[model samples]
Target: MNRLTFELRLVLRSRLSAAALLLLLLLSVLAVWSGMREVQRQRQTIERLAPLHERDVAALAARYPDSKDAGNPAYYTFYNTWDPPSGAAFLALGLRDVAPYVLRIRALGLQAQLYEGETFNPEVALPGRFDYAFVLIYLAPLFTIALLHDLVSAERQSGRLRLLLAMPDAGRLWRRRVGLRYALLFACLAVPACVGAALSASGIAATIVVLAVTAACLAFWTGLSLLVATRQWRSVTNATVLMGAWAMLTLVLPALANVALIRAIPVNQGVDLMLAQRQAVHGAWEIPRAETMRRFVAGHPEWKHQADVPGRFHWKWYFAFHQVGDESVAGAARAYRDGLVARQAWTGRLGWLLPGVGAQAVLHRLAGTDLPAQLAYQDAIVAFHREIRHFYYSYLFNDRPFGSADFARRPAFVPHAAAGMPGGTELFALFLLAGAVFAAGVWRLGRLRMHGGE
Candidate 1:
C-alpha cells in the first residue's frame, strides 16, 4: 500500500500526467453537459409541438365543420406522431441527430410520409455531435495513449530503466503504476456518465452495462499503449504509432466499413419504394374510377359490397386506392427495412473486432438511438397508420358523416416502448477483446529486460 501510494504521487506530480487527466475530466464533463442540453432541447421541441399541433387540428376542424363527406376531413387532417427520447438518450444522441423524431402523417400512402426529410443543416451534422459516446469512443483512447506511451520509454531515456527492472518486485511495481493510471482514467469517464445517468433517471442496469463497456474500452487502449511502450522505441515514435492506430480504429475503418456495408446491403429500395408508391397513387388518377375501385375492392373484400362511386369522387374510393398504393410497394418496403437491419447486424459483428465500434453499438443501443431504434419508431408509425385507416374506413365505407365533433375522435399516435439495451453477445465480445489485449500487454511487460531490450 505504501508503494502504491508512492507511485500515485509520482504519477500526480508529473506535469504531463496531471494535465492529461484534467483535460480528460473536463472533456467528459463537457460532453455529458452537451448531451443533456441536446436531450432537453428535444423534449422542449416535442412539448412545444403539442400545442401547435392542437391548434392546427382545431383550425382544420373549424374550416370543415359539419362536413357531409368524410373525404375532405380525411384528406386534410394531418396527425402528428413522435418518438420521445429514452431515459439514457442523453448519453448518446445517435440517429436522433439526423432522423426526424416527430413526423406528421395523414390517411394517405404511409410510405410517402414515412421517409420525409428533416430540415437540419447537413454541414452541421456531417461531423456528428460531441456527446458522451463520442468522448468515450474517440477521445478516451487518445488520452490513454498520451498517458501510457512513455511508461517505459521515459525511464529508458533517463537511464533509470536498468535500476527499475533490477528491483525484486519489478512486475508488481509496473502493475501498481499501470493499474492506478487505468483506474484514474476509468474514473474520469465513469464519473460524468454516472452523474448524467442519475440526472436522466436512466435505468441502473443500462448504466452498469455502459460502465462495463467503458472499462473494457479503457482496458484495450491501456493494454495497447503498454504493448507499444514496452517495445524498444523512442516515446515520440511510440506516440505516432499509437495515434495512427487510433485513427484507423475509430475513424478510418468505421467509415470504410460503413461504405462496404452499404454496398453489400443495398437499401436503395427505400427510394424505389417511395417513387413506386407515388407513381401508383398518381397513376390511379389516369385510370377509370371504376377500374381503381375494382382494384381496391379486390384486396379489401370488406368494402366489396359497397356501392360504386355515385359521382366523380368518393371518400371510400380515394382512401382505398391510397391503401392500394401502399400495398403495391409492400415488398420493396420490406426489402428496404431488411437492408437497414442487415447493416445494423453487420455493424454489431464488426464490434467484435473494433473496440471503438463496440462501444458505440452498446451505448447507442442502451440509449435507444441506433438504427434499430429508428426502425422501431417506423414500425410504430405503421401500426398507428393502420389504426388511422381503420378509423376513417368505418366512416367512409359506411357513408357516415364526419363533423367537427368527430375530429376529436381521431386516433392519437403512440410511439413504441423504448428498445431493450444491447444484448450479452455484444458485451461479451467487448470484454473478451479487452481482456485478450490486456493479457498480451501484461505478457509483453513480463518479458522486458534490464538490458534495454524486449
Candidate 2:
C-alpha cells in the first residue's frame, strides 16, 4: 500500500502526466456539456415547432372553412415528423450533427419529400463534433501515449533503471505503475461521462456499457504504449512511433476504409431516385390523364371503382398522378436505402480490425445516433406518409366532404423508438480487439528487461 501510494504520487508529480490528465478531464467535461446543450436545443426546437405548426394548421382550417374537396388542404397542409434523441444521445451526438432530426412533409410525392431540404455531405460527418465519443476515441489515446511513452526511458535517462530493475518483485512495481496510470486515465474519462449519463437519464445499463468501452479502449492504448515503452529506444523515438500508429489507426486507415466502402457499395441511386420521381411527376402533365389514373389504380386496386374522371380537372386525378410519381421511383428509392444499410454493415465489419472505429461504432450505436438510427427514422416517416396518403384517399375516393372537422382527424406523426443497444457481434468484436491488444501489451511488459550495457 505504501509503495502503491508512492507510485501514485510519483506519477502525478511529473509535469507531463499532471497536465495530460488535467487536460483530458477538462475536455471530457466540456464535451459532456456541449453534447447536453445541443440535445436540449433540439428538444426546445421540437417543442417550439408544435405551437407554430398548430397555428399554421388553424389558419389553413380557416381558409377552407367548409370545402368539400380534400385536395387543396392535403396539398397545402404540412405535417411535422421528428426523431427525438435517445437518453444516451449526449454521449455521442453521432449523425444528429449532420442529419435532420425534425422534418415537415405533406401528402405529396413521398420520395421528394423524404430527400428534400437535405444538404448531405459525407465529409461533414468525418470530423465529428466535440462530444464524449470524440474525446474518448481520438484524444484519450494520445494522452495515454504521452504518459506511457517514456515510462521506462525516463527512469533509464535518470540513471535509475539498473537500481529499479535490481529491486525484489520488480514486476509488481511495474504493474503498480502501469495500473495506476490506466486507472487515472480511465477515471478522467469515465467520471464526466457517468455524470452526464445520470443527468440525461441514459439508464444504468447504458452507462455500464459506456464505462466498459472506456476501460477497454484505455487498456488497449496503455498496452500498446507499454509495448513501445518496453523497447530499448529513446523516449523521443517511442513517442514518434506511437504517434504514427495513432494517426494510422484513428485517421488515415479509417478514411481509406470509408472510401473503399463507398466505391464497393456505389450508392449513387439517391440522386437518381429523386430526379426520376421529379421527371415522373412533371411528365404526368404532358401525358393523358387516363394513363396516370390507370397507373395509380393498378397499385391501389381498392380505388378502382372510383377511378373514373368525368371532368377536365379533378382533385382525385391530381393526387393520383402524384401518387403514381412516388410509385415510379419506388424501386430506385429502395435500392438507395438498401445501399446505405449495406455501407453501414460494412462499417461494422471494419470495426473488427480498427479499435478506434470499433469504439466509435459501439458508442454511437448504443446512443442510437448512427446511420442505422437515421435510416430507422426515415422508415418511420415513410410509414406516416403512407398513412397520410390513405387518410386523404378515403375522402377523395368516397367523394366525401373534407372540412374543418376532417382536419382534426389527420394522423399525427409518431417518432420511431430509440435505437436499441449495439449488436452482440459489434460488442464482441470491440472487446476482442481491445483485449487482444491489452494482453499482448501485458505479455510484452512481462518480458521487459534492461541489458547490462544499459
Estimate TM-scores for all models.
Answer: 0.97, 0.97
Candidate 2, TM-score vs. the true structure? Answer: 0.97
Give lDDT tens digits, candidate 2, residues 168-238. 88788888899999999999999999999999999999999999899889988998998899888889999
State residue 273's C-alpha deviation in candidate 1, in Å.
Answer: 3.0
Model 2 stretches with alpha carbons more than 4 Å out? 120-127, 452-454
Against the reference, the lDDT scores of all candidates come to 0.89, 0.89
Model 2: which ten-residue window has the lowest total lDDT? Answer: 445-454
Clashes of each: 0, 0
Q: How far does residue 275 in candidate 1 sit from its true spot (Å)?
A: 2.8
What are the RMSDs of all candidates, in order?
Answer: 1.5, 1.6
| Candidate 2: clashing pairs of residues | none
